[model samples]
Target: MSGERRESGDVRGILHPGEQARHRRLTRLTVGPALSAFADRYWVVRWDLRGRPAYRAEVLSFPCVNVTFERSDLRTGGFVNGVCTTKYVRELSGEGETFGIRFTPGGFGAFTGMDVGVLRDDSAPLAEVLPAAAGLAERVLAEPSDERRCGLIEEFFAGRGRAGDPHFALVSRIVTAMAEDPDLTRVDQVTARFGVPVRTLQRLFRRYVGAGPKWVLCRFRLQDAADRLARGDRVDLAELATDLGYFDQAHFTREFTAEIGMAPSEYARAASPGQSVAR
Candidate 1:
């Protein structure tokens, strides 16, 4: 988002399609090839609305982790965010900026000593993880430009002598499969396909991903629903529900409304050209 290498599907799984327009500009910079093994991208978000209303953005987060620095407070240092199982909601006000490192799925296991499960849906101050990191936020935010900000984070992770989980590659493969395959709507499907026992799959996800297999499957499927809705594609509630492996249309509607904070029809209307939806 900072550099010139923007791709077509940079954040397809995180932000709902067509939803980025509601906020101030959010951009991502590709990591130097050195950190590509673990980090997916470096994201920068800036908003300057001192005289205007606040903005809010919502999404069902992917099962990934991030190390984030917010300029609003320097004493808090920075935070290492773990995978979130629930929907994500952020309300922004005033003028501020943040730099974030979104780790590839299961890629953060090593950095946090695989305390992944404890960090589920939570954040730990970077100072708590490594005392030497106490000044990281202040140092990074002091940079004059996004490019230099990302460079600071990149250099930190690139030089850190940490070891990743042995299952990182395996988990990455499985997660990639879940994101790519539409028929993968059940944990059982993953187990049967991968020849991994249900218990093993559960442990891998809990320890490395900070979420269970079922949650990942459901979240990714819901992402598909959001993608279709945001794109203005004609969607039949019943058929779409079945396509997502829901038991029935009513079941889909209830869960979708609960997780997305709106009915599917309302989400469609909000995602239409020039319309904005925030939760």
Candidate 2:
């Protein structure tokens, strides 16, 4: 299957677009309506390396959880990966396929009452995270059709019904606003705009999104910067920094380099077609 380019939303986190063709194909699908309240999207990744060297795909993660069913020469199982606070890396080799559910930020908390913060930077068996999903990995991996796999996922969550808690809905709205409004560079802006107190906002995020609001804001801004640079856009660094609410270019550069593993200018050049990046 050919890789589907991202249709909408920011596509910055998935790195080395030029190298994707050499290793794998990724497809993203929408969730069925009944499960849409909890899931943002379903993603399928297939790769065949055979005799070729393995490719490491690096990603900047959002404040969301991912439940995945993977079948490969390396392993076959279901895993729940919580909101990651740092760069996420995956190595593809031999041959493998994976089906994944990316829960909306704070959405997973609707299903399980556990404080999302405890799962940060951690991963666990799906059965451990959601006992209702026991054996789901085997069922999904056995299906040859992607459509059917989606159906199975929908059936699993649809039976649970909609999330009734008003807190999750409120969390979703706040998180969505943070992602969409570039001018919202400060937590106070979020508090003021949404009429949520600073402490309450932080507490809600810790329990539901697994990260603090300030961290989420910075991640979104940096993701935007990476996307622009990867597109080889001739952006003015200082201007872009100011727009992202950074005090100055130097601070922005420091943070970007630390998180993305490369300076902005270097990333821009590496993203140029035919240019290579030393990861």
Candidate 3:
């Protein structure tokens, strides 16, 4: 049987962890206290694929927004990616580098004072959201040092002169709880735990998170499952279903297939060494 895995487990959300090392390097830097209210972390991904076949990188994304600055042979620009409810995929070839800012669930909303729901499953040029940032991307992409690039990005946000949102802290706490607690499978559990009414919780999430609490909860659990299975861990499907709060194995299978695009067994097999698992 697959052992119990909690939402709080160290799952990086990379669908093909085994293959990641061969083609790319990913680094995550801490978000300083000064910017913690608005951003989660900074990530630098560098890849070199010259004379090698293109690699497909797939991720089981968390419920958060990201601002990415990419300099690649195929594309070069900065973009703001909203919450992607589904799996995220990208192809890597040639040499390239990307610096990204992962915003906290409610953090992006605090910056624009607009409902984040409109950005769900979509992305926009960074200039559109922060016109002042129009020239920031070029400067970031030109900087070779990751640390300096991060400083530039940080300075841009820190210089915005906006006050911290009281709601950002509240939302961060609630989201962190949902991600770390496996027992929080139901929305009512969240309401009870946080003492927030159902309607208020939903409204807050819609405006800030771009997705409902239930989705965030389920997504975290699903990511945990994917992380475990991709590591080739032996799992009992029924037991996993129960751990994820599914009514039955069948229900779990349906949901997994719909979101992951493959059955659990197939995914595990594909993750096996020597198997070419793309997407």
Ranking of candidates on TM-score, top first: 2, 3, 1
Q: Native-vs-model 1 lDDT?
A: 0.76
The residue-by-residue lDDT of candidate 2 on 20-75, one tens digit each, is: 64578777887877668888788888998999998888888989988899988766
Candidate 3 CA-lDDT value: 0.80
Clashing pairs in 2: none
Give the range where candidate 2 is weakest over 10 consecutive residues by summed lDDT.
1-10
lDDT by residue for model 3 (195-279), tens: 9999999989989899989899889888887876776556778888888888888888888888889987787777655433322
lDDT of 1 at 157: 61
Clashes of each: 4, 0, 1
Order the numbered candidates by lDDT, best leading.
2, 3, 1
Candidate 2 Cα deviation (angstroms), residue 23: 1.9
Residue runs of model 1 more than 4 Å from their true location after superposition = 1-20, 73-76, 161-164, 273-279
Name the better of 1 and 3 by lDDT.
3
Q: What Cα-based lDDT does every candidate model obtain?
A: 0.76, 0.83, 0.80
Question: Clashing pairs in model 3?
Answer: 2-236
Give the winner by TM-score.
Answer: 2
